[model samples]
Target: MGAQEDTALVRRGYEAFSAGDMDTLRELFTEDAVWHTGGTGALSGDKKGRDAILAYFGELYSRSNGSLKLTLEDVATGGRYTIGVQSGRADRDGKTLDQRTVIVFTISDDKVIEALEMAEDTAVASEFWS
Candidate 1:
């Protein structure tokens, strides 16, 4: 796919994620897709496969008591790589998390094959999710 098409696909993923549409997410990612989250938090790790990635997303929702909100700021694509910038906020265990994150995605055949997540404030994110 071209850069525009790839960007659109990623935007669709962000929308699907915000809407909690797991079915759409499943369709957007490959069966062997991997998602990487950095930091020392419970949610930080390499989530292998589509099922594991979906479960990580579910954990985000459950941990935040369905209060996690993600706002997509921008998306850019080059070749098969798409980068998405977003801001997220949530409250958990009397701790408030408000952070910006950038996710670099490797797409192939119109589906995401891998995603690497980078939080703007890793220490704060780690504390919040720890």
Candidate 2:
């Protein structure tokens, strides 16, 4: 796929994720996809396989009580890689989390095969998830 197509695919993923649409997310990812979250918290680490990635997403919703919101700021692609920037906020256990994050995604066969997420403030994010 070209850069535009790759960007579109990633945008759809952000939309699906924000809407808690697991089915769409499942379709957008490869079966052996890996999602890596950077931080030293409970929610941090590599989520291998589509199932594990979905589970991590579920945990985000559960932890925030469905209050998590992600706004896609931008998407840029080069070859088979796409970079997505987003701002997010959520409330959990009386703590409020407001952050910006960037995700580098590797696409193959029109599906996401790998993702590496970088948070604006890892310490704050870790505290919120911990």
Candidate 3:
């Protein structure tokens, strides 16, 4: 896909996530897609396969009592990869998680095959989610 298409796909993924449309989010991923969360916090890990990834997100939302949110700030695409900068916030256990993040996506045939998520301040994120 061209750069525009690649960025558009990533944009749709963010829109689906922000809208709480899991079905649409799943449709954007390949069947065997993988998702990784950065930091050594409660939500950090490698979730293999689309099913696992979705389940992980479900757990994240549950932990935050449905208050977790990610707002896409920017997207840049090159070759078969896209990088999305986002602002994330969540509340759980009287603690709040607010951070800038980057989600790197690998896409093939217009489907996201892999994602690696990183926080601008890993230590703060870990503390907030711990």
- Model 3 stretches with alpha carbons more than 4 Å out: none
Task: Assess each prediction's global lDDT (C-alpha) against the native.
Answer: 0.94, 0.94, 0.89
Measured by TM-score, how close is model 3 to the native structure? Answer: 0.93
Stretches of model 1 off by over 4 angstroms after superposition: none
Residue 108, model 3: Cα distance from true site in angstroms:
0.4
By summed lDDT, the worst window of 10 consecutive residues in model 2 runs over 73-82
lDDT per residue for candidate 1 within 83-113, as digits (tens), equals 9999999999998999899999999999999
Ranking by lDDT: 2, 1, 3
Q: Estimate each model's TM-score.
A: 0.97, 0.98, 0.93
**Global CA lDDT of candidate 1, please?**
0.94
With a 3 Å backbone cut-off (N, CA, C), the pairs that clash in candidate 1 are none
Total clashing pairs for each candidate:
0, 0, 0
